[model samples]
Target: MTDLAVTLLLFFALVSTAIAIALLRSLFAVVMLSGVFSLLAALLFIAMDAVDVAFTEAAVGAGISSVLMLGTIALTARHEMKPKRWSATPLIIVGIIGAFLIYGTLDMPAFGDPNAPVQTYLNPDFIARTPKEIDVPNIVTAVLASYRGFDTMGEVAVVFVAGLGVTMLIGGSGGFLRRRYRETVLSRKDGQA
Candidate 1:
């Protein structure tokens, strides 16, 4: 019962985000919806006992991505042209996809079953490695921050590149003002001469 509730909450959050992304006309609204989606996903990860993933998603997906998107939007146009009507075909497609996802969820294992294959398979390796090879009190941190450090570095680099690209594309740091200043200087020189 608890598992079902959590799963339903996650599904509803995801679907609401998808609908918001599709239906919202403004880019700012879409960015905000994406943040909401990211927050929901982080909560879902927490519910599934993936604390590291939830923390990363909350920090990067919701916080950083939304901030970067808002910065980009500031350099772009403020208002979008209002459409008179929305087409129904996309909504129909979305509904079908949602139904298929829900159907697939029926086959998933019940949460926290000790006999589940995933736990059964990993339990031995988890027990054997902690005292000998890993030497860490908390295995999750050791695995993510130490064993898989390269992958984490790569992910951070990717995020840095994305921020760089957004900064380059937005171009909001006074290009027009520099040109206007140059023009003013030239006009002042001409008037003096």
Candidate 2:
């Protein structure tokens, strides 16, 4: 009962933050709200007993992504340009996509169903072998690091590239643009004088 309540709270908070992000025009405010959304998602993962996912979300989604977005805001516009006219077409399209996605989930088996594929075969295999094969006390870590090594490496590489891209954006082109702007203005003043 308590977990359900917490889940509901987190779900509502996540929805609220998403709505706020959508409504906000300020890039800074949207970035901060996105961090809030990541945090709520992390909390929800924790509530669902997915500690690894929670940690990843907290670190990647909330931490690095937020900083990168802030750096992007520093490089770009602070406020979204006011649209001349709002259209309902995009919203309607999104609604249609969302409805289709919800419909797709209708065929999914109910949660915790004993006859599920994972419960019947894959999970039992892991439970039986993780102790002897990997010798790791925690099966989740062993599976993530050992069994899913290539996938984990791919994830790491992706994060590294994302960080490198953000760093390059902030320090490379962005710095050059600022310096060029200042020099151009100074040169214009000198030319005028």
lDDT agreement with native, every candidate = 0.84, 0.90
TM-score per candidate, in order?
A: 0.65, 0.82
lDDT of 1 by residue, 114-149 (tens): 887887886668767876887888778776676678
With a 3 Å backbone cut-off (N, CA, C), the pairs that clash in candidate 2 are none
> Which candidate has the highest lDDT of all?
2
Writing each residue's lDDT as its tens digit, candidate 2 over 91-111 gives 999999999999999988887
Decoy 2 TM-score against native: 0.82
Candidate 1: which stretches are off by over 4 Å? 82-123, 156-193
- Model 1 score (lDDT): 0.84
